[model samples]
Target: MGASQAGGLPVSLKLPGIVLGVGLGGFVDGILLHQLLQWHHMLTGTDSDNIGVKYYSPYTVPGLEMNTVWDGIFHTVCWLAVLCGLALLYGRLAHNRRRAWTSRVLWGWILVGWGLFNLVEGVIDHHLLAIHHVRGGPYRLWWDLGFLLLGALLVAGGHLLQRSGEPLRPRDADDEGGLR
Candidate 1:
């Protein structure tokens, strides 16, 4: 029930892993919407004709001129989250010796990361600014809200699963998996 038993590594390692996961997920959205899919950065106050049309440059928004300022902000926040998560993880590893620090289920982190991405994106895009809507129609507001809810559930469930899968104290000599 300790970090050493899991893989001779601290539970804090998991934080960087989680941050990397979240950052990757965020990058996908940024690439698709801001670069590839070309969706307007919903938070930037730019409007698209609909879901299928080509995106035009953002109109004037107060002092701001760029259309994807929101995208910039989103990327910044995502990177910051990753950094913060890493710092916390490192700090925990440095100070704590509890073997069973967290859970062994890496999948839990994956799920949590996915959930967080959806939740943050949905909130920033649909609710705070109301740039477009989930897909084009079909009650975008509720859809976005649901996405956030789904993320929360994923995070909660994943953590629970990880805790439940935790191995017992005195590392199982027969185990083969690398430090979780």
Candidate 2:
């Protein structure tokens, strides 16, 4: 659908924003939770009791190695998502004469994208797949819930911001090209 029907944001810009947000948000989660905080790993919950595979320990040498590899793979996927977003943005804006970059719609969609990333990842990894938790302890559920709550807030906040922005209008054929 066109921008006017899609809440005033162009698909060209919105899609890329969301893609970039997901990638950047994943980087934050991977770096902050997995690396800096040392809270959990990709397969921390993959215990033999649950899946017939030995429990993964982030402390032991072998465990750490395995987790590290998995983390690397996760990061690679995030990087690829960001690259795809960049490619989309470049392709969409390359010939456009409008200054869409400065539009609030771009940032709003980015927030929505990041929120979506958190919600999807939190639900799939933390709940459905049961591959890991936000933390390993009695309070793990609380942490996971808190993560979901934050995602919800982001989505709500982003939607509000998007709605507050002016709708993007199509550029006239005679308009000069370049950012406004």
Candidate 3:
């Protein structure tokens, strides 16, 4: 579908919004859960079910160190994604001759991107890979399920917001100048 029909924002803008959302979402997950809360790490749930060899721990000094390193790597990847998004946004804005930054469409796409991140990460880390959980304990499954639910909510909310967004207004020549 065309940009206007798709959600009032072009794919050029939507792509960057999603990329930024994923990057920022990753930061939130890493910072809040991994460091601040001390709940889980990249390898916290590894081999918890005896599926494979265990690697690290969240409670021990060495294990924490290793996990910290892995977390750093994860953060680096997130940072790179953010940079890529920024680059894409810059390229689009510079060449498209359209103003997309001030639209709700961008925000909606961002939410969708974050939801996508949560769904993929939650499934991969919490379920399929057994790398870690939102919070470790007997109730881990519940926490993981809750995370997925939140993701679904975000996606739905974003979709609604996107549909409700208006088209971007063209820039007027007289409105370009700053206050005298």
- My TM-score estimates for the predictions, one after another, are 0.53, 0.83, 0.83
Worst 10 residues of 1 by lDDT: 44-53
Q: Tell me the tens digit of each residue's lDDT in model 3 across 1-180.
A: 334323424344578878987888899899998899878888898857335747787678998898899999999988988898788766555222344655577778778878888999999888888888899889999999999998888888877776677644333335562111
Instruction: Please write out the lDDT profile of model 2 over residues 31-126, one tens digit for every residue.
Output: 999999988888887762234446668878999899888899999988998899778776655335346666677677778888998899999888
Which regions of candidate 2 deviate over 4 angstroms? 1-11, 48-53, 95-98, 169-180
Q: For model 1, how does the per-residue alpha-carbon lDDT over 1-180 read when each residue is reduced to its tens digit?
A: 445634654343345546654765677667775567654454333253333433434444532334466567768877887687566555544333244344455456655676677677677566665565544444655656766787688678767765666533333455453333
- TM-score of the candidate numbered 1? 0.53
Worst 10 residues of 2 by lDDT: 1-10
Ranking by lDDT: 2, 3, 1
- Which portions of model 1 miss their true places by more than 4 Å? 1-24, 44-65, 94-103, 137-146, 149-153, 167-180
1 against 2, candidate with superior lDDT = 2
As a whole number from 0 to 100, the lDDT of residue 2 in candidate 1 is: 44
Clashes of 1: 6
Candidate achieving higher TM-score, 1 or 3: 3
Task: Mark the regions of model 3 whose C-alpha exceeds 4 Å error after superposition.
Answer: 1-11, 49-53, 95-99, 169-180
**Model 1 residue 55 lDDT score:** 41
Q: What is the lDDT of residue 115 in candidate 1?
A: 66
